[model samples]
Target: MGLESAVSLYDQSTRGRAGERRAPGAGARPLRPHAAGDRSVGFAEVRDFHVEVARRADPALALVPLLVGGDPSKRGKVIAASADLRSRGLVPGMGMVEALDRAAEARWVPTDMRRAREQSGLLRAAVRREVGAVEIEGLAGFYLCAPADREEALAVARRLEARVAEQMGLPLRVGVAPARFAASLVAEDAGRSGARVVVAEDFEQYLLAQPIDRLPGAGPKTAARLAELGATDIPSLRRLGLDRLEVLLGNHGRSLWLLACGQDPKPLRVRRHPTTLSREESFAGDERDPGELGAVLVRLSERLEQALQRDGLRAGRIALRLTYADERTVTRSHSFDAPVSAVRELAVAARALLDRIDLGPDSVRRAGLVLRGLEISGAEDRQLDLF
Candidate 1:
């Protein structure tokens, strides 16, 4: 996109962002990658996403240790720790008090779900305009299908990095690889280190050397299990032989092996048919009952499911939003194993997201569900995430 066009797009998408608050952190250098693209899949992750949203909106918060989450006085957990706080060893999921004890001078900022969603929507739209195919990883990350050839793919990525940083005021780390799993890992390191583009021919040698524990499904326990079996790295796992790995780790082993060798065939699901569906309810009064909130979510899910099916669509992502009596907003989302159009599946996912919120004894003044990252039914496919 041209500079004038990028500015125009930024203006249209970011009208309400003048009041955005941001946390402290220096941006990284732009990554320039040269590699052939053969069915290349790319990922872009916003560094310090929630905290950046806060910092950009509020200049005073810049260079401040900001915490995006519940009431620190009431002992809410830190959903997002700013880069400044993180540098001080404060991490997300730590209690607000603990975070403050770690960095007693930090600021507690209530999360603005509505603003975050708007920013995410704007970023997705921007990517869709420059690049044809895109997949949203919640509010902070994006998966893009690079152009078939390498040159155009790299150009799109360069423009994307500049566009996001220039237009959105959000720094992005771009990773282009043959497979999604590898692309995600690349994005993580690239976000902090620099941009990385791995060609199809180099993927196996590039990805397999990384430790086996870095993959999503290979958490602490899974990594330990693999370690016990002497399958500590992708290359070693491949050398361990797929048959034995399958017996030892089930589908997870199979998936990891495929990811390592760039054999996973999950397609880049683009948002060809765009639709944003949301359901919400305002309570008569503050309701604190978990069951009541869950019931509302079920009703919303039932309606959302019907809407998706009626249109022959499925939601690739689902977010649960809540408004507290104090007027604070919370939005938590979960990616589906696969895009889902079923009520049971959607509700189950929604309830699970609701569980992630720490209501404690707080009353919910309003609640809602937003379905985005949409795709036409059967338009693309994805492998299930192994636990």
Candidate 2:
């Protein structure tokens, strides 16, 4: 978009929000004016990360069909597969046994997450060298904010891709667009060692031409439901106004409607650390028993603890969200004097916060725990209390 249109959109998006309350470390920052006039956003993906890792590890596997995952004999699922296997419908998340059946001669490479993490860090550093900051998309991609117009954005992406390839020996495919989500989808569709650039004028037309399934959150079930509603593409989806979509699909439907209307971009984030970690579960029915709710909290805390340990991080705040059967939600939060990573500590804090909430006649249908104010495990000193 041009400078005027970009500023207009930013104003529209942020107009009426004054003194809005936001949870700490929630990644709630909105888009702001760029430092150097208008800029475009882009996504860069490390094409076939696992397959490339396997090839780099052993040159002999360069041309072979490789399936990366766990033991098929133990009900493992496919993590990544070679291009040939993917073309044959052997995609990630398929059962290893099924994947093996599809490509009988495909070599099985055990998932090397440690190596992947190391490589991903290297890739991010390389991209940041060219672009000041980036938002990491899982372990294989990055959301980059470029310095100037569409052409400059495209050139930046190209330079980053080439530099990453030279330094890390990994190929990157980039997509530049006026919107973040559009950039992500375009990057996913871009050819190996190439970039796709979508200008502001072409943004609307490009989005309308994309299949409905291309939008995130429009999974198989939602896509089928949309098809049943006679909406098979972005244009048809947009025709269903915001109110109708909200009534039919709830919040996700509203979000989809917004994206369909092209309200998806925001200022890019650096995201050096994950903003928040949360786990939630819905009850089979309305639940009033405190014991059941407490058990769920413990389970969620344990899951968060595992994630914290995996990431070598700790949380300084925890928020508990209780969703009533009527779809209303109440959230209560507490901050820790010292960051916590233990399940026991998290569960205790959550239970304390839960007790503070006045649960009336309403029964909770879902419970969730959000961990924020995160930092590296050893970043701060702990205070010891004398008994």
Candidate 3:
């Protein structure tokens, strides 16, 4: 029998790109390549390897992919309204004007990466609380221990699914496969389905047919380049010699080659606590009144204030989460010159943030608030006499 383990990778930055695109001048600095037989892989290859190794240890390895929180709209109103708008065909990244034009009643908004990260961290903690020791692949996804036996793995997957939903109020999908790549692929297919499993025999076949672009780590540019080279599918890419692949895609090419053939060598690392606290909510129905949504922001601001007070802290930075009913979420944040403790003050700042947001009623279903850059509050700071 192969190794009895599991692998999972949470796709990073799923909250459709909101920040300015990195300038070409801001490209990552080149790093030293691993010496042959170094037995060490770059950070980029770690998740793929973790899944592969876990699968080798356990044929029933489960692969779970988590969309970052707030990738969906952050406004409670928008998230609640998104399901209806989706049927009309709008999606994240659509221009506000275009989305509105496509569906007059559609609601749309930006995402909040900070709050999403916070919510994701909570989900990770919740998972860890239940499962004594599980591997967190990254910020948004993790792998739970699944046994080699089919029934047992499925049972574990079910439990994981329930815990995530209960704690985070977000749906999670789990896919089990004999190989890590297969499991990841299947998990993507099972998005929003909660849980799914694929056997070894079908795993390889499924992988072979998948577009190279669909593979983890193979982004749009890389996929387009591969297609240009007549390597449109995983099997075709796998058929190319390693040297040829390296020449075509550089180190990333070599990494992709290894992944294509299901030969990954990385380990899963545990997640750590973030430096901040945050929360997000989605509405159950579309709300046309911005006032109603503003009321939600008031509640969110109060919650953040209470949480900071409980921790004996004050926030120096704050962010807003806006979710369109179309499932698109956007986040914006700012740092103040001084720390703030009052919910009313935070709400004022949040309103300023909201003014910058253009998403309307039909598409908004969720909203989120994130507070960070905290500093310990002293008794003097809290006393009314200080003013």
Candidate 4:
């Protein structure tokens, strides 16, 4: 079968089973162990993650072309598409109307970000149990450093695939290489094989074999520009040399050349917890009374104070957001002289900011409170006077 057909076929097979046909591997050789302490960056991508999740949530979505994003009648882009559509170059961020034009019979659904976030957390937790630290690219892809021992790294990848499959019902494909970019490429090319590992020695040939689209950050525009330079694939593009590429594409050209040479010194960015906390509530009717809105702000501030105390954190800045009945939103903020964690301090600051915004003729529909610049509380001074 052709490469496109093979990829489309695998993309369509989202039931936790391997593709019936496998494409030729980029670098199919078995992985050999490197020197001890050599860090190997590995990337794991859940194949057809959005489609698979939607299917699991509602089995009725199976065996049909599916499009997940905004309402078709509204102005929005496509968030995810079926494998066959994607194989035909229907990617995320394309206009929904254009996407519908391509897949006329496809079913469209709104994005379920809340559910996607929950599933992503579960996926991360499963991988974290196998490997201590991981950097998630999005809801579906993850980057991690594996053991120096090639066999052990392969075992970790296998275990991760099995763990996610059993726990989250998602299939995982992994690729291990000396650097993050190459590893990502390897993982993409791994396809239905589950995992592909490339040692430093084979990095050059393996990278050379990849197509131009595999290069990170090189979108259709870059491809068109490269085509203008008579460079169609990785090898031809490399012939352009660093000087010519830099001259042609500027700093971005330099980055492309580095990846073309299998040199990606970038490090994994481990995921961190949220730095800001916010609470919001929508009013039932068009409530324009200042006293009523101020009361709501006070309640929200108290809730914020309780949350800060529970987390042992203090906020250095407070913000208020008001959503008008016409759907227009406005925000105002104030910074404190020092971090504050008490309900009195939060309410005082929130009320002061709320006073700054003019309600105008628009009736208020929602009020929100946000605490920013958070830091761990050092000690409690209940006796300190703010007045």
Cα lDDT listed for each candidate? 0.74, 0.78, 0.57, 0.76
Write one digit per residue (lDDT tens) for candidate 2, span 212-298.
887878899999887876779887887655544555676787678767766672456766556788778789989999889999999
The C-alpha local distance difference test score for the whole of candidate 3 amounts to 0.57
Overall local distance difference test of candidate 2: 0.78
Best of the candidates, lDDT: 2
Consecutive 10-residue window with the lowest summed lDDT within model 4: 24-33
Can you write out model 1's per-residue Cα lDDT over 1-387, one digit (the tens) per residue?
A: 443554354344333458452221112122112234456888888877888888888988888778898888888888898776787888888888888777878788987875675576566656665675567777777787775556776777788888777778777888877777778887776754246777766766776568877776778987887676676777666665555455455577666666655655355676644578887887999999989999999998887776676556788899999999999999999988888899999889989998999898889999999998888777764423332
Estimate the TM-score of every prediction.
Answer: 0.63, 0.62, 0.47, 0.66
Question: Which portions of model 2 show Cα errors greater than 4 Å?
Answer: 1-37, 265-267, 272-387
| Candidate 2, residue 225: lDDT | 80
Model 3 per-residue lDDT at 52 = 25
Structure candidate 2, residue pairs in collision? none
Worst 10 residues of 3 by lDDT: 1-10
TM-score of candidate 4 relative to the true fold = 0.66
RMSD of each: 19.3, 14.1, 16.6, 13.0
Native-referenced Cα lDDT, model 4: 0.76
Candidate order (lDDT): 2, 4, 1, 3
lDDT of 3 by residue, 1-387 (tens): 111110011112112267443322132333221112211111100122222222333454333221111223332222212433545654444444555556664323333444544554556566656554555555556654445455666676777778866765555667666545455566666655456665544455666777777667889987877776678887678655455555445678777876776555344443332357776767788655768778888988887776666555688899998877776778888888888889998888888888787765456778888888776676445686768
Best by TM-score: 4
